[model samples]
Target: MNAILNSARAELLRLRKWPAVWVTLVAWLLLASLFGYVFNYVAYKTGGSNFASEELGNAQIFAALLPENLPAVLVQGMPMFGGALMMVLGAIAAGNGYAYGSWKTVYTQGPSRSAVTAGSLLALTLFVLGVLLATLALFATYTGLIAATEANTIVWPAFSEVAKSFGAGFLVLEMWMLAGYFLGTVARGPALSVGLGLVWTLVLEMLLRGVGGLLGPVETFTQVLPGTAAGSLVGAIASGDPSAMDTPGVLNVLSGPTAAVSVGIYLVVLALGTMLLIRRRDVA
Candidate 1:
């Protein structure tokens, strides 16, 4: 246990100084701000529409940007760009060790493979938690400003609502991150792992989903895919008229409970798979 803690501390310190980590986090924040507020605010002021606010009146668009809708805004992007970015972070973090021969050196330094891998996973989890909290704070600030500027009554979401959104977002992001870690472990390098992960997350899954609509077996398989589960989980929270919910990657293919369970399963499987692979395989 102490070994794992020490490894985690060391991994966190390393990740903190890595440029890729900062770039990914900042990219997500920028995306969240743009999609969550900037575009909507612009449309509201100009009496125009964007993907998310299409077919809605200016008043409805404006309302969606207020503090009350922060929960939905927070997680709406996770299944798409948010998840993809996190997967990249995980892939690079794990794969870079091999690219730079850091993993081999660490293995030679006396710690068990399990301890080192477990510590790395723990550090990644902490980073995911930090991103979620940072996003929450960023969104809160944006919504507060919007509310004050519009002279609207501030109605914060209920604690339960915020908690549910936070949980769902964490599950979705963590699942993707673990999936990336697994890929990085399997590939044993950052380049291939990052490339494959981004392709699967951003392209392959969507294509498969599209094809699934016409094929029963494919559709059944798609139901269990990480993207499907993540989308459904967000859909459950951001439920409304489907046509108006133009957020990409948000789906309603499964019930809320079912989607949550599927994501949880993926999270466990990916984490365990990554660790087992690291433990059994040669670092070199």
Candidate 2:
């Protein structure tokens, strides 16, 4: 237990030292802020209902955030954007230990490579959750400020929902880190692991979905695939309005339940893969 905690702490310290961490954190903030900015501007231009009133229940508050005629592209892509950045960040977090050759030191400090890997993954999980929370807080504060002077009420429950969505984001982030860790250990190439991790996350998943669409009943199978599942979970949480999608097509397929199942499968796959890799691999 002590070894695990120590290893997690050390991994956290090392993560803090990486420049990409700062960059990715800032990027997520900026993108979320951008979403708030555009929504606020549109609301200001049009006579939108004030969302600030506590009278407005959770559903009502949601209506205020997503006005009618909201573009589908932004709605579908916005939440995924944060997850995408997080996935990249997770990849870096998982692979960086190998890149810096710190896994050797971590293994030396712990009795086994498995313990060290678990500790490192634990630290990354905590870090991702913390970041997600901070992002939600900031988004709520900013959105409230935007709605305040302009007839928007601080919808507390809606903010809670946003926080929940952010938690979903953290789930995806953890999966990415775990997947990267397994790849890191198996491939023993930080560059390959990180590269493949991003590709599998950003590209391969999309391709699978597209190809699955062409084949009958393949979409169901694809949904259980790692990227699709993680992506769906985050997407469901971040979707503020139903009409946010302009063209209601495949992008509209994701629902909370579907995402939950997808993400669940991803967790199992990552866990089993990590354990299998750790058991077989020797610490350098």
Candidate 3:
């Protein structure tokens, strides 16, 4: 345990020193602040307009919004603001050992091969979480100011609700990150893992969804995919009120419990697969 902790710590320090890390961090902060400001501004400008009310509601609805929802917005929008990018970066971090054929060097360290890999993965995931935390903090400050200026009062979502949503998001992030890292390990190239993730999420997933829609009943088959599971988790967190859904659709099937379970399954399956792959595969 101590070895793992030390390895993870050392890996984290190395990551912190990388130029890419600082670049991504700065970009994330800028984008997050911009998004929060724009969202709040638009909501404020349209405060009197019925258009805003129709979608999110007026001051009355705003007052009723919970504090917990703040985290949901930040996390759910993460994919847009460097969540996927960070995962790709993490994949590269993990595959770095193999990039220069440095596995011998890594394995030469006191830590075991599994320990070194796990430590790198842990450091990257925690860094992503830290980014989330920073964005959430900025969001809270912006949200509080909006509420004050708008003078809206209502039962904001509890901090617990936000935490619950973060937990769900964390699981989803871990599963995706692991998938990328493992792909990098097997493919022996960071680009393959990163490209595959982007293609799978942005292209293949959408194609599958379209095909499922055309096939009707067979859509359930597509639901088993990692992307489907991730969508369910996001849906659960982003749903302000199911009663307010614009239309009844399959999204209704993804209740909180269902989303939580689906994400859990993905994580467990990926974890098991990683263990099996590492145990049998050559380091090179």
Candidate 4:
């Protein structure tokens, strides 16, 4: 237990000091703001809702920043929310030692394989959760600043809705990190792991999903695919909000709670299976 805790602490420290981590977080914030700016800009110029007739570019910023719209915006942005970063870091966290032939050193030092792996997993969880929360805060803060700068204010969504959005985002983010963590551990190549993850997400799964949707019986099963559940959760959050998509109902195809539960179960199984594989493998 102590060994695992120590390992986790070390992982947290590395994550905190890592330049890539901070850089990605900052980039994500700016990306969200950029999206907000574009949305506000086009809307203001075209007589968008809640925009003054003569409102200029600055006031247009309030369109995406309005508290009522912020949650959905964050949720829908999950795909580009540094999922690849999580996977790459996930590879580094779980597989880097194996790449450099360093796992044998750690294994022989003291802790059992279980302790080391478990500790690292725990640490990765904390680090990623912090990133997700920070992402959420950055979005909310930037949005509020826009609203304030525009001399406009909007009531925040009900606490229940806000909580739901955050909770959903957290769950989905964890699942993606687990995908990265598992793939990194199994593939053990930083580039290969990341590339595989991107292709799996952007190509294979998408193709399957689109095909499933077009097929009668398979459409029902699409909700259980790799990226479908998370997409469903985001869809649930963005439901009824036109700003979330060019077509609002595109994400509303699956049941949010069902998808969430499925993804949770899938992650638990995947993590346990990876640990078992690690235990059986010879490290050197």
Write candidate 2's Cα lDDT for 88-187 as tens digits: 6656665666677766666666467666767777887887777766665665565566557557445455445544655566666666666666676666
Residue 177 of model 1, lDDT score: 93
Candidate 4 versus truth, CA RMSD in Å, comes to 4.4
In candidate 2, which residue ranges exceed 4 Å CA deviation?
39-79, 158-163, 234-240, 243-255
Candidate lDDT values, in order? 0.90, 0.60, 0.63, 0.69
How far residue 220's Cα lies from its native spot in candidate 2, in Å, is 3.8
Show model 3 residue runs off by greater than 4 Å. Answer: 27-37, 43-68, 79-83, 153-156, 241-253
TM-score of each: 0.97, 0.76, 0.81, 0.85
* Ranking of all candidate structures by their TM-score, best first: 1, 4, 3, 2
Q: Order the candidate numbers by lDDT, best to worst.
A: 1, 4, 3, 2
lDDT of 4 by residue, 1-284 (tens): 89899988977787788786677667766665555445554565465642222333434334545777777777766643455456666766666667876677888785888888888889878876787677677777766765676677557778788788888777776777788778877876566777887787667766776788679777766666757777777878877555554322125656878877876887797689778877888775
Q: Which wins on TM-score, candidate 2 or candidate 3?
A: 3
Each prediction's RMSD to truth: 1.3, 6.2, 4.0, 4.4
Off by over 4 Å in 4: 36-64, 217-221, 246-250
Better of 2 and 4 by lDDT: 4
Error of 2 at 95 (Å): 2.6
Q: Best-fitting candidate, measured by lDDT? A: 1
